[model samples]
Target: MARRSTPAKKKKTAPRGKTKTGKKPPKKPGGFKRLMLGAAMVAGAVSAIIAAASMLELDRAAHKAVNDLAKSSPAPDTSDRTDQPKQSDMDFSKGYDAPNRPGYMVERVPEGENPQNDTETIPEPRVNPAPKVAPLPSPEKGFGAGTELAWQKFATHVPDTGNAPVIAIIIDDAGIDKPRTERAAELPAPITLSFLPYATHLPEQVATARKRGHEIMLHMPMEPTSRVVDPGPHALLTSYDKVAILNEMSWMLDRFTGYVGVNNHMGSKFTADPERMAVVMQVMKARGLMFLDSRTSAKSVGYQEAQKFDVPAIERDVFLDDADDAAKISQMLDRVESVASKRGYAVAIGHPRDLTLEALNKWIPKMQAAGFVFVPATDIIRRNGVKVTG
Candidate 1:
């Protein structure tokens, strides 16, 4: 009891991890410190947003600068012939239809016959009746050796350009837009124009395009990978037997005159089927028409089949305006340049969009300056894997 009196009341100590109130201690800053941390976090978020907005504004400014530069650049258009009549003159000229031909000849009903009495008076077939047999042009003996069985009549005229890179730009999906298609035809000599057989005014439009120094190719509709991708009404399908596929192809091939070849509109599925494609290439060769493997699908065997069948064939190198941005289209043309540089020639396909047209308008001059020659699609084809020449 005498020693316990000296051992005074023990000094109380706080728990290691708890407050005096028996709760968890504040492990991190709190109160004024916590408020300061929250403020710092909010300020950082705002700074990040401002930086993003600034970056976006810089990108927009860069695009604007590019657009302005393109506009300011002078385009030397040698494509437009000095002798050619003005657009105003052409518009008022007597021949609105340049190569005026009886498009889809039809049997006229007797004028006096009553509609009820007469057989179902059919509206004229959209296309002219296809020729049952149009003999393929046999190769002339002049070119010798590898050139046998090749047809030059269908080939577009190419100047003796030596060994310069040749570029073929084919505008597909023509005939739907009369004005734009016609305008494209007038772009430059040797720009290939591929017309859709099902379009209503194909014959007239094709004639005009051909008259304007553009080479022609039939844009044949074919089955794609997905059922949702409707190529068109009479598209060639993998489901079709040889006879049916050939029949539909014949109709498309015979749609118009003066085409160098046929190219698929959307044949991702049909082109891969060797059986169907073999029939198509055989028919193509037999008809004196070359074939362009649109290369819509990576699995397509069209080029190989054409090689095996000795059918003149080439594959599309670039597709312009897959996105309708003018700058992007110009970039695709740059791809065309790379292809042409590598392979001695290249083939690019584009639609009649404003961007495509604009890009071409700017690019044609630049390409010419670069010493690349623009040729037709047929010029680059090969027979038996041998480059064909007339």
Candidate 2:
């Protein structure tokens, strides 16, 4: 027993973390696990950044597409004038032969200011128009009543002709075609030029025409007999109420200054309505504006209605360029001469067509040499002894 108990063996302790049984204890998580967790966090951050960049690229693509589309097309016109003078207020007056044609714009000038330097572009009536304004607050006020009638105040001065038959060469539908209108204004002095309200550069056009010794009148649009023909923007229609009619009139009258009166433009249907005509005459009388009955319809009550309301009135004796044929226009001029010879005066309406202008250029000087007097439209009204009454 003493020998067996002789050298007691010391327990072998495992290196560092091992058990006495000589098996190593399981390794706790350390640097390798920490490195893996950090790698996972970095990968997540990269994925989020990639997603954000992709979204931004998509947004930029959308914006570029929109900008490209915008660059491809021109903005369409919201309001008035292009040529063709049928029921559509056909801009037959514009001269297509010229370059640098002015775009349609309603340019207005303030009272007592020269329009020669004005560059502001005002808004015009729309193609498919609704009233852009409310009825005038006081339609009757500032319309030139009593002795300060518009017709008398604005009448172009003309030298009296002793015992000569007068002829009024009224150029209708002016100002739409700038080149043609400018050419028309260069014609003989005291020639009456009736302009459409929808034309652009109205103040400048009117001012120039006046300076050249031309009498100005408003070529007011009215309903035509044909439903297919459009009477143009802000035209006076039979369907309009009194307020609507007056509102349209106000818009047109406010376009430019230095005008004697108004005459109908293609108003075959509107001039035929007695009620509508009566409404027109009332405004004329109230405003002291004379009425030139275009006599568009055989059944038109324009003159009679004017008489009833005591509006200084006259009817067209002839139309010089209805057919646009040179021969026809020339023949019509002869007829105008005959009519003037018989009635002591004649009112002939024409346009600024190539043929018409050519015919007029030759005829005017010839007629003047033959003792025929060229006078303003207002002079013809006066020759008939029709005075504006209060």
Candidate 3:
């Protein structure tokens, strides 16, 4: 066993240097120390970067919060107040007051501040105040007095002719203006002018018509189904009580004088209401006036109501001048003539238009030549044996 043991291999060694033979070579640092130093340096750099990022984020968040608050809040009042700064006066170059400017109150960034994360709010401009208005004057009393006097003068001029089959031409809605009434007076035959009370030119129109020897009547306004209709300023309605009707009637009668009868101007609704019509008839009867129904509504109870009140009444048979055209008017004239020939007499209503007047001028002479007599409305009523209530 001793002979079989093998000799161990000897280890190799390097020779020493001659210049710095006594100095030994520097030993390398341990791997753990180098790794720890490298880690410390990296951590320091990372901390600096994180701090800078955090500061930037904080500033961005502050700016955003300020913009949001401004937008959510109510706008400041700038009208009439000089104490506050105007939108034009705001300095937006610094970005802080940019949000206060007319266009930048929502997201304006301050100068030197990054706009990528900045925000601001803007407000609307104030409007001017409205101007004050003045109040209107009160209406004057007895405004239609002159109109009544003109009518009275007309009534005094009624001729005392014997009763015959009179053909009355009651021209309604007169007294609108002096020129119109004066023109109406030029008719060859006498007419009954139903003048509207309290018209713009009531006094002069009625007086002029009366001076021309025309009979007069009151063209009283009454309510209709349409709310858009203007029944003049003083309209009679079903809603009015007896006192109101009487007062209105009296005022109307006092406004115009020579009216021998009363007629509806636009009494579609009033004529349909029996109770209201009764009141109107009763007032007419008391005033010793006759009643003429314009027949604005087919369902009108005007005739029945007048009879109930013992007032002389008649309804419009034909509106002679309904058509505005000359050809249509001529056709209507022929129809009127046919009716007159057959019935012996007929009551026709026409306006004061130039067309109507021209037609009348031509047709009247023809009728006279044909032996057709022209009579007043009263004469027609009396000749027909229609008893006068008054």
Per-model lDDT: 0.65, 0.69, 0.58
Residue range with the least summed lDDT across 10 consecutive positions in model 2: 128-137
Which candidate tops lDDT?
Answer: 2
Better of 2 and 3 by TM-score: 2
Clashes of 2: 4
Please estimate how well model 2 matches the true structure, expressed as its whole-model Cα lDDT.
0.69
Query: In model 1, which runs have C-alpha deviations exceeding 4 angstroms?
Result: 1-151, 382-390
lDDT, residue 117, candidate 2: 21
lDDT of 1 by residue, 1-390 (tens): 466455569888876876667866557765999899999999999999999999999979856743443343232232432432111111212122422211111112234522122112222322221111223334433434455342455566667566677788989877756677777887855788888776666778877876777788888877766543456656777766555565677677667777778888877777887877877776776666777887777678888888776666767767776666777877778777776665566678888777788778878888899898888775555312334454
Ranking by lDDT: 2, 1, 3
lDDT of 2 by residue, 1-390 (tens): 355556888997558855668876777789999899999999999999999999999978856744443333333231332332332334533444322221221112224532222212222422221211111112244553344677877887677665687888888878877777888888865699998887778899999998898989998988776665555677887766555566678788888888888998877767877866777776676676778877666667887777776667766767777666889988989887776665567778888777888889889888888888888877766654444222
lDDT of 2 at 192: 90
Backbone clash tally for model 1?
0
Indicate whether candidate 1 or candidate 2 has the larger TM-score. 2
- The residue-level lDDT of candidate 1 at 127 comes to 23
Alpha-carbon deviation at 228 in model 3, angstroms: 2.3
Q: How many clashes in each candidate? A: 0, 4, 16
